[model samples]
Target: MFLLYITALIIVIFLLETVVIDLFIVRGVKPDFILIITVYSGLFLNKTTAETIGFAFGLIQDALSFKQMGINSLSKFLIGYSIGSLRENILSENVIVQCLFTFIASCMNGIIYILILKGLFYSEIEVLDFFKDLLIQSLYNTFLAPIIFFMLNKVHFNNVREFRGRKEEARTD
Candidate 1:
């Protein structure tokens, strides 16, 4: 059931990503919704689970996306792992803090992605493209992060806990 929920969420995010806002229009950037999910999941789940989901989601994103293969996977995995580890120290359960982290992660992910792509594809990659995409995507994700975090937190944590308790009660019954 949890797997199904996550799958459904992934599908929704994927669809919204293409048709929703033209975040890239301002600076020509590419946003990774899966990456955001990985970060959020990592913050909530254990390390192994987080990394596994991160890698899995990254692979899914890479497979669906048109960008260079493996980039999404690597970036998402790293972001998820780092964020999950950071959560131990930060106690960032607040919505505002979560949003801030998401924004920062999104921005950093964008920059790192562009850098990796440029490094792999071209020796002399243009800086303007990197900066433009990074800025636009960061801003866009920042705006969207709060809403996403709210929704996900409700579904993944609240509903999940409810489901678990219900399941346990059913077992005892």
Candidate 2:
């Protein structure tokens, strides 16, 4: 049931990102909804689950966009794994922490993608322009993270263990 929900949600986000999000673009930059979803999965789901979703959705996005295959997949896979690993040490419930994680993940994804593109294809993308776009996209993703987090929280997944169990345990002391 949880897997079904996540798969459906990813499809919906992918559709929205490819077909709808461009309408709301600002300064020629649009929020990456799929990226946000990957971050959310990393923060809330198990590492393996999150990385799997990242790779799958990244492939879907690549297919839809006609870009170099596997670039987005590799970037998102790393982002999901890296951020998901931090779940053991950080307070995932904090909005500020969520925002920061999204920002950092977005920046890392951009850097990794650019590096791969440059290294593999020798694409002559201007460094400053890429940085400018990266900054804008990071800020845009950060702004959307809180809202995405709130919405995701409402959709309970049985596979994920609630942190409330720890609080309940402490209360008995």
Candidate 3:
């Protein structure tokens, strides 16, 4: 049941990010819902689970996109793994911090992805254009991250019992 809910959430976020928001509302800037989900999942979920979600979502994205396989998967895997490791160390439950991390991670992911693509394909994209798009997309993702995070947070809670359980744990510890 948990897996089903997460899968459905991923599908909805993917569609909303790529189809509804990117295609219709903001044609120029494409928000990275995958990155947001990966970061959110990593922050709240266990390492293996977070990485798995990231890998699965990345695979879905790669299958949907025309680009080569494994690129998205690898990037997302790294992002999820790294952030999950950080979460294990930090004890933060703040929404603002999560959004900030998502924003920074999205920016880093975009830059790293661009570099990886260039290295792999030897394609020389314009530097100015890359920065321009990166900035715009990062801002866009930052703006959208809170909404996605809130929705995913609810999924994580699952029910009032789960929420209460977490609150109890936090208070106890």
Candidate 4:
């Protein structure tokens, strides 16, 4: 099943994330490959599938980091839903569209993470520094999105929706 492949990807990426973080750190941040895949799922897959992809990626991150549970999952789930819902209204295949949404989603992910930390744990994070980090990571994610998206195009899950789609013209006959 396609889901099996996705699971494999999640595991491999998780490993790479942990193993190569220090080697790939730029300005103390590595490219958010998980976020890139989440964004891609939203752009190219059905809504429920997108949400699942996002939730899975985030849950893995949360579990590995040992932070507050569900924080990452909640953020990524919302991002996936928001982006996936827009697939019908926007040009999902356009590189520009992909880059723009990835940037927005990345910023939103940071905001959600920051807000949860600040509100739940009373963590002190300066707004300026948070914004700087958010911008850098958002741009980092955005920069890598198109390249990754292109590779994922080979999979093209849009045509492989899990649920049945709208009825064909035969229904009108």
**Each prediction's RMSD to truth:** 5.5, 2.5, 2.7, 3.4
Model 3: residues >4 Å from true position, as ranges?
A: 21-27, 158-173
Candidate 2's TM-score: 0.89
Task: Choose the strongest candidate by TM-score.
Answer: 2
Per-residue alpha-carbon lDDT of candidate 4 for residues 1-173, written as tens digits (9 for 90 to 100): 56676678767877988997786577987777888888888887778988998888888788878666899899999998998898766767788999999999999999999889999988887978988978988998999899878766655455433221432332454
Off by over 4 Å in 2: 157-161, 166-173
Estimate the TM-score of every prediction.
0.76, 0.89, 0.84, 0.86
Model 2 lDDT-worst window of ten: 156-165
* lDDT tens readout by residue for model 3, 148-169: 7777667667553464577579
Estimate, for each residue in 52-110, the C-alpha lDDT of model 2 and write its tens digit: 98888888777776567998888888988998888767778789999999999899989
Give the higher-lDDT candidate: 1 or 3: 3
Write the number of the candidate with greater lDDT, choosing between 2 and 3. 2
Could you give candidate 1's per-residue lDDT for residues 26-143 as a string of tens digits? 5556666776677677666566666777778777778876765787778878888888787655645566777778777887777767778778866465788767667777777767
Error in Å for residue 132 of model 1: 2.0
Report clashes for each candidate as comma-separated counts.
0, 0, 0, 0
| 2 versus 4: better TM-score goes to | 2
* Maximum-lDDT candidate: 2
Better of 2 and 3 by TM-score: 2
lDDT score of residue 131 within candidate 1: 72
Question: What do the candidate models score in CA lDDT, each in turn?
Answer: 0.71, 0.83, 0.77, 0.81
Instruction: Give the range of the ten consecutive residues with the poorest summed lDDT in model 3.
Output: 18-27
